[model samples]
Target chain A: MTIATFPPEPPPPPSWTRYLGFSTDAKVIGIQYIVTAFFFFLIGGLLAMVIRGELITPAADLVDRSVYNGIYTMHGTIMLFLFIFPVLNGLNNLLIPTMIGAPDMAFPRLNTAAFWLVPVFGTLLIASFFVPGGPATAGWWSYPPVSIQNPLGHLINGESMWILAVALSGISSIMGAVNFVTTILRMRAPGMGFFRMPVFCWTALAAQSLQLIGLPALTGGAVMLLMDLSFGTSFYRPEGGGDPVLYQHFFWFYSHPAVYVIILPVFGIFSELFPVYSRKPLFGYVYVAVASFIIVGLGLIVWVHHFFSSGVPQWMRDLFMATTMLIAVPTGVKVFAWLGTLWGGKLRLTTPMLFCIGGLVNFVFAGITGVMLATVPIDIHVSNTYFVVGHFHYVIYGAAVMGIFAAVYHWFPKFTGRMPYEGLGKLHCLLTFVGANLNFLPMHPLGLMGMPRRVSSYDPEFAFWNVIASLGAFLLGVSIIPFLLNMLSSWIRGPRATHNPWDAIGLEWLLPSPPPEDNFGEEVPTVISRPYGYGSGEPLVEHQAEIERRLQLQEAAA
Target chain B: MTSTTPLAGSAPASPEAAHGHANHNLTGFIIFLCSESVIFLAFFSGYAILRTSALDWLPPGVEGLEWRTPLVNTAVLISSSGTMVLAEQFKAREKLWLFRGFWLLTMAMGGYFLVGQAVEWSGLAFGFSSGTFGGTFYLLTGFHGLHVATGILLMAIMLVKSFIPGNYTGGEQGVQATSLFWHFVDVIWIILFLLLYVWR
Candidate 1:
């Protein structure tokens, strides 16, 4: 039988403008996520400053207690939902198909639908602030009775809206998760084996799978809470004979793994960037991959650690604490591997590298604090204090936020056809680093001093540390200026970037700086060698030829 | 191109091209039906958890609503699944009129099940807002009815498309997917019926 080979099809015309409302191009969808997430990040940051400002003096009276609660609630909500998940998934949606050498996501229409849902859900969440009783004061955790009994508005609809918005966001994540999994599983180019795939792709796959299983529990918890509040259904009402602790169990089942859901992709980002800046292959490829899977596996079991003070059984507490601490082993392996990758290699010290290095430094402190929290006696003292707040800030702002910035700087060339100002970029990184530590570091001492969280003001004895923290917050606000300047300046008139400006080895860098509507031009890649296999020194064409030959030989044998 | 060649190392098949003619529509319908399965699974889990944990719950008070009527509806839904299978068989054989007839019969049976659900709902003493039991019960069954209604709508669309010339190019695949969806709906209803009426 003669196999017919057709000529390559012409590239699709740029319908970006016309199809703006309905386009499924991963690049455009990614841009939408990046821009919208940045907006929310700014809003969330402003809320943080308000919180810090209010706490600067003992009995300062900057904002009332109710207003203070709203500030912190919105801060956590915006950071988790609006900023972290969208930014990570947005980067994945934009880059994964291109990186894996596919035309688009496995389900492109569904991908588009998922992206649109973010803004809708985000708008609803933000709009709840204007409701009669105000945004949910139940904290981001929104624990029951407090969450359920709060008068949300005239119709008590704020909590309902919160549940509905969260459910909508869950739906979006589920759809995106399904698309990422299917695309990575079935739609890879001919020779892109699972092991040969990029670390970011691996992380994306793991995170999305986590989302698929994890989200349903949250949705279940949210629905039960909504029912309890709206219709007097006793899912969590103790008066009606429902146990509130059951709500905690169901909620943490998803929420605990959700911490990994936020941080794992950030790990993926570092996995990609550390090698590029260090000019070496990732030190332990298989180890890092296995570690990510272990994190996901371990993440589900350790959620009870969040409820250590709730009087759970001692054996369960010990089990959870042990699992939580054991998680640090794999996490430690990743950190050491990253440091090893950076060792003995010529470092670039670019904007991305600065953030990557900054992330490593901060992650060390965060991990140490995490280990401290793992001990039950210590956690019981600091569970709701500034200590817990400081620890998470070190993880989220220190590790995850820095990793996100690293990604933005690394991939901005691919997204925009222009390079960000490297000098300004470095400045942003430095100020953000110093300002972040200054802002969060003192909170440890404050927490140790028995200063609780979510309070508008503090006692006079703790006023000195609060002043230092507020100063850092103000400096942190200034630090973002250079980033805004760099982004706006670069977007307007920055130097045009080459397709592969950094001599990157990935398939994404092989395309145009700003890829065409359909992603590829003439060549549809079938990979043979690993993406970052730098030591072999074989030209990419030789690898391509080898892949083709293998494919053809397999065809003949069959 | 021959079927004997085996589909190995070929240019990647477009999802649409792989399910050609009769199979294309069936695959699309089945894929959608799988998505619906996830939705119902969520509802079922919620219902089961609520039922076991109900405090001081009463058996629902509804007149003329012994387990017998839902049992009969269960049989009707199960038979509709069989008819849906036969419809796909006719479709595969290119028996257009028989395909249309069975498709309509399946939709009509689905409609009858919905009517039975309405009668069941009308007889309930407690509504969705009454308590945890009522909330879970109504939400579970209500979501299932929505799926049945959607399936009926899809079948009606297929029924109309069967008569239009040049409309049924993707042969058995589309109908196969639709049948999978219909069967899924049927199976879920059976599970719900047994759990709600007979399990206790």
Candidate 2:
């Protein structure tokens, strides 16, 4: 059979205009997603700084209460919807097809449509700040009654716009789920069975499946909320005998699993990086892979834990509490698998490795607190307090964001065809680790002291911790500079990346960095073994020697 | 797990199946329909909860919905599903004219169902803000009607594409996707019918 038909030399890189325009290429779409998401990340970070600035002292001096509400609301909405979700999707678009040795995604046009919806919904979301009511003062959870209130009586108030934007975002994500699930299931390279697939692909499948089943609840709820707010439905309007708590059920049903939808890919990132950095095969590969689906299953039922303080029935609270804690078993399986992978191996403390280790440390902490919060009593005690804030930030920022940074650093070579500056990457990781811990750790004590979250001002007793947290927030803000600089300079004039810079064992590593326009071209490499054969020297793909020879020849010709 | 047969494991994408790509598209489409159905489930659940909990479920003046038009509308919509199946079967057999006739008939039935819904909406005694029951009634039925309209639009597009001479004869995946979507809309209506009309 025909195999290893590498082009004589690499074609010139595609024009920069492709990034701005509608390009169906998965790589372009991936870059577009990443860069756009980072832009919103910066915007969200700025809003966060504003929030921390207001809370620095025990007074509401920097921004007024209404403005503070808008800032924090926008901050959460932008960060979760625009940054974390899109960035992971960008990685999926770039990696899934390449990892499976497909030419491109199964539904390339659908993928493009999904990416474009991000900016549309993002713009509409941010535009809510410009509207009369000053942008969705309700929390990111957007619980009803509060979300349904519109004193301004404007046709397109902030809450309405926010609901519309969120619903549109849900539609975009559902489309993305369809595309990713289809591509993963149907487009694997020859011999890449479900078991032989990389753990990342497994995580992606699990995450997208959650998206398919759970996201529509949120979208439907948002639409009903908008109808109540604008079109005069009583879905959540208690004045008209509507039930607000049912809205809570709908919101948390998706929003709670949404936390997993965001973090599962990060878990996959940890699973991917730990083996490569430690020079070992992933310990308990099948279990780590299977654990993701387990997490998805439990993720669905455990959403009611978010409602323990919202006055759910005691039986529901008990049932959800059990399911919530049970999720930790699968998660712990992954954690132990990573630890086992790292144990007694030649370790590389590269930038990605540092971030992975840091993220793992933070995830373990988050997982403990997650179980704590799952207990109905503890959740009731810390409900709507800064402690809950601390716990999730540990998951969202301390773990997930840090994991995302690790992925960027690890894949920078493959994305841009140039190696990221190691020193700058390390600096970014160090500052981020220090800044995140400082910013979030104080909140735990403040929460235990009964200090509530999402407030502009607090009592004088909370002042000391607030000051330290604000300073940490500013440091976290500064942490972005090194990352932007590294990505910019590396792409411009950093050392040219070899085909497999880290000697990684995946289908993506076999191709040249920033792989060709049509990935794998005519001869799609049939995966022969599992990807994490690190020191075992087991071949990953058939015709390995021929493929390597052709790769070298093409590189030399270029 | 360490090793796998290269060729046999990837048989789905092999060159053997005559409709391999079409099958993948249908798989993706069916999955989309499944996801879409959950949105309707959310609406249905909301209606059920509101209906059961409210002391006075109906509005002041109106006793309840008149089920006659909707029953006929439901029959019209359900019959379209049968026509849709015939259209797809004809396309598979390469009988282009028969496919077009049945496809057009299905679209006409879908349009008729939508018209019937609009008439029923217009005849309703209560506004959308009447109460929890009225709000849910309009929201659920209106949402379902919107889906029916979308399905008709999709079928219209496929019908237009059929005029391209050899579209269906060459095998059109879009036709199957649209039909699947049409059937999904019908299934949602069945549930909505039970909750909104028959259950009372």
Candidate 3:
């Protein structure tokens, strides 16, 4: 494969203002998404703290009952929609083009438009808090009858506002999924076949595919629900002969796959980080990549597991239980691949690696508990208990959020042209790991003891575990301090970073730190090797001399 | 830049490169349509479940929907798909006027279907709040109607762009995408018509 030896046009000077404006550059949009999502993460975290404060005692003293419902509802909604999804989209925007050797996304203007929808919907979601009836208290699922109840008797009530925000966000994500899938399918450099691409790209492909296939169901369901609530329709209103169970079918059909949509990228992060730190080729690289799609296929069918106790027939529940259990096989494949990669290798316990290991360990725990929750009998017993809460927090916070931290630390160098402070990063990881466990672990027993979820108060016996969980929740809240400080300080004045500082073997590492506006410049590199090629002397790009020339130019510029 | 690509047509810019760019756009648009189809599937499933299970499928007093108007509307929409195909064919043959003629006709047929639906709704005793049947019928058809309106809007834009000198001389990718969307809208209406009127 020939690499063009043409002189590259210099990228424009970096400026902070572009991140604040309507910059179509994927890198700028990526940072904008991450920073904006982080702001919402803080808000969601504050709501969690309020929930924790109310639960610290056996009495609902910290907030009123309705306020507690609103707080918990907003907590779930904001965490999933606002914080997790947007932050992951941010990562997708940043990593996809660079990893695949593309100049930019296939639809750059559409990418910027998708990023802008975040703040618009974010404002709408937050505005619900100021609305007359407070935020929607029907839980984030927003099931009907409860959701259709308009106690405020106003047109612009909180529930409608929540649905509007969610629908708008769904539209944004659909636009993003279309862009991501097209880019991944058509924009890879010459010689970079699908098999040769990094695991992260494969995972992003699978996740966005889930988005394209599953998100529309939720959006359509929301529209019907909106019509039922506002326009006197009965799509989900039982009083008008509309079945509420039908809404569950629509909601869980997407929301279940949506869990995979969140975790698959984190799984990609785990797959990415383990090999880099262990200084070895990724174990069963093909299997790891293929397992992602397997997860996606199984993910779509297992959505019925969420409806086990929603008056579904026994045959349906039994069938769904089997499908839900089948997901564990592919997940087990990924977990073992990470372990095998780490086996008998020169392990560098860097902060990113530490977070990856922590996240992986927690993921395994979540998987076991998930399997427990998958069984029809067990699920019915702890259907709406804190056990379900514990299981997902382990998945969402324990695995996904920790994995996000690892990615931020790992890519901080490449994105910001500076190395994150290892000291603060380790402290953040430690606090996060411990706090996450303390916060989520007690819920297992409290749930086994039959404590229900979404309640502000509990019985005296449940009070012990609740207090400990609240303490852990507070610690988890405090864990963000070191992380924010680390990011701000490192980006502002940390030691400057060199391209390929970690000696990573992806296409992104072959370019200058933060790359350029046209990520690969005019002549994108033709990848010649599989990723995670640690200790493999084979070059990743075909024309090694051209990459060396580009590096020399970068060094000279620096 | 080769001139052999069908849609690239005679252009000052490179046709070969534009062909690949246009393919990416079309592939993405098709993927988007696939997602859009799932939304219709959701509503269809909802309708099926309620029709089978609910006691008041047609409600107590209201009569079932009349088949005559929607049958005609369905014919109008299905013919619009054929016209859309002809529009693309004449564009490929470099007959710009025939392309615009068929394109505008296809849009006109779509517009007529909308008018027919409004008239049918006006005559029906059932309102949106009548029952589950009323909710599902209106939601499904109204959703499909929205797609039809969007397709017409897109076709109208393409038709306008064709009038500008040198615009469709290069053969607009928007023409192809718009026609694909129109055909998709037509197909969805066919399924929707059968489900709403003929199924019972």
Candidate 4:
């Protein structure tokens, strides 16, 4: 075989204009996703505040029923599609290549395409709000029949826009998923075996795989629903011999695993944080990794849990309930493993660590409620109630949102070349923690008292809790102010951060903070030790030794 | 787990290995193909479910969409897949000119197959809005046509890129990815052809 010669020195970094189209540098693409997704997050949160304000009193004071429906609908749509998914995608885009010590994604152009598509679809979805009939009045589920037969059916182009935009978003996700999986599988640095890879990367890989398999059902459902609306097909119209329930089945099939698609990466985020803060290796690396895959596998079978009251057969319902309950086992294993990682170690109480710990508390409550909702009898009672809303917010907002906050604070230095204000971040964390629980915790009671979700008005008796929840919503909005300030101020005025601020072990920190265009200098990393290889009492010595050995090998080879 | 270093003290491997190891671009294509398959698979599954659910197995209204036309389309697609494989083989062997010819053949066959589908679509008595049969048929074939268009565009790009001297060497791996994608499109059509035409 002919031996290939290396180019004497690596070529100069590509121009900025070239980076715009197909740059393989993960950090740049990651920043693109993060900024766009955060913009949507603010829009989604504003929609939530509007919905809460309307429901603060017994009467529908703030908006009409249709307008109220639009608010809640846009809120859920933006949060799920534009906010949470993209945030995770952004995190993975930035960190996965670095964690695994790759120069960039396997396909650079595809990564650019994926990141850019988000803003396009996001603009389409947001613009629907200002269109003729306003944004979609149907819930985010966009269940057909009702969705197909809107009151302003003649005037509303919202449904078409919704489908087109969502389909576009789906395309973006599929591209990102492909890029993530391929990068992880084909581009890992030497010695970074699958088992040795960071848990965050493993979680991201699993989440992306779930996206790969799970999104097609939603795409199929969206197309059928669009046809039912525009083309007059009866894919979901029972009058035309089409079964509406089939739409539910198809929608939930994707949406259910999609819940994991949103949460699994956050789980990885926590997995990374716990060991780092606790100053120990993760207690059970394989357990956490295996649990991530198990969640993906089991996530598909439990979509019927969302529809326990949809008249599915008893045996099928029972099977779904059992599968749903079994999911708790893997989740519980992860919770305990995280606690084990935290036990008996030098715990760091930084803002990121605090947010991660707070995430644990909220997710515990969320998981408990998740198990409760899994029961067939309980789910039937709370199927369309505020309890369901509360349950999901806990998972999405409490677990996923807090996890995003943790990742932002943790990785802010590497991305910006400066450290975030610690005092402001801590303030943000505390206020957010209290605000999130106060906003969502009372809904369990309101749901138990028979308060239906998606209504413009409710009985006077539910007013007190509604008022409290609205107040909490305001507090939550206030809590984000500090975060925004910290982010902006840090970028402008904060001191430059060291490459390894936290003494972290990931390959990302081995390079300069805000890594150069090509990420590494003349040399690319070859993994010398496992991520989270912190030894007790003498971690500095061990890390130095490992670094020196790797540098010596590189020098000899050069 | 083994401590032996694969790249230690050795000159870099051949350009092919370097491209494969360093870039790993094919992995992204494989992953894309996997996702694209699921999208089509979902549509196919919907068709199967609807077919099984229909009272009078095949709907009575629509006609002229017989197995023969689609059968011919299927043959064209399968042959195109063979030509795609040939193109990849030639490109791998550094027969750049031959590779381009096979790609042109595949693209031409793909266009013919797409035109045949449009003709089949026009002859149908039903429209996308008509009923269940209309909905499923248009969706399955419409999405397949979209893939066919994308494949043609990709092939055209590869064909043009082949003429640039330095760009042709590591281009085979990318061609291989496009070939796999073409094969996936063909496989999906086979499933759709069996379900919509032959089974009926």
Candidate with better lDDT, 1 vs 4: 4
lDDT of 1 by residue, A95-160 (tens): 898888776676667778998998898999889888887787888888897888855335545667
Q: What DockQ values do the models have?
A: 0.17, 0.36, 0.41, 0.30
Better of 3 and 4 by TM-score: 3
Off by over 4 Å in 3: A1-12, A549-553, B1-23, B169-171
User: What TM-score does chain B get in every candidate?
Assistant: 0.79, 0.85, 0.86, 0.84
Q: Kindly report, for each predicted structure in the order presented, the TM-score of its chain A compared with the true chain A.
A: 0.93, 0.99, 0.98, 0.93
Once superposed on the true structure, which residue ranges of model 1 sit more than 4 Å away at CA?
A: A1-21, A150-153, A540-558, B1-55, B59-66, B161-195
Question: What does the TM-score come to for chain B in model 2?
Answer: 0.85
**lDDT digits (tens) for residues B1-200 of candidate 3:** 11222222322233324443324777788899999999988988888888888886887887788898789889998988998899888988989899989988998998999999889878888888888888888888888888888988998888888888888744467887888788788788878888889997
Tell me the tens digit of each residue's lDDT in model 3 across A182-230.
9999989888999998999999999999999999999989999999888
Encode model 2's per-residue lDDT on A283-382: one tens digit a residue: 9999999999999999999888877887678899889999999999999999999999999989999999999999999999999999999998999999
Candidate 1 C-alpha lDDT tens digits along B1-200: 11111221243443433532111223233333454455566556656655576665554463323687788888998899988889878877888899899999999999999999899889778776655566667777787888789889978877877888877774334555567777787888888887777766
Ranking by DockQ: 3, 2, 4, 1
Task: Using lDDT, rank the candidates from best to worst.
Answer: 3, 2, 4, 1
Which segments of candidate 4 are over 4 A away from where they belong? A1-24, A150-156, A536-558, B1-21, B56-65, B86-104, B165-167
- By summed lDDT, the worst window of 10 consecutive residues in model 4 chain A runs over A1-10
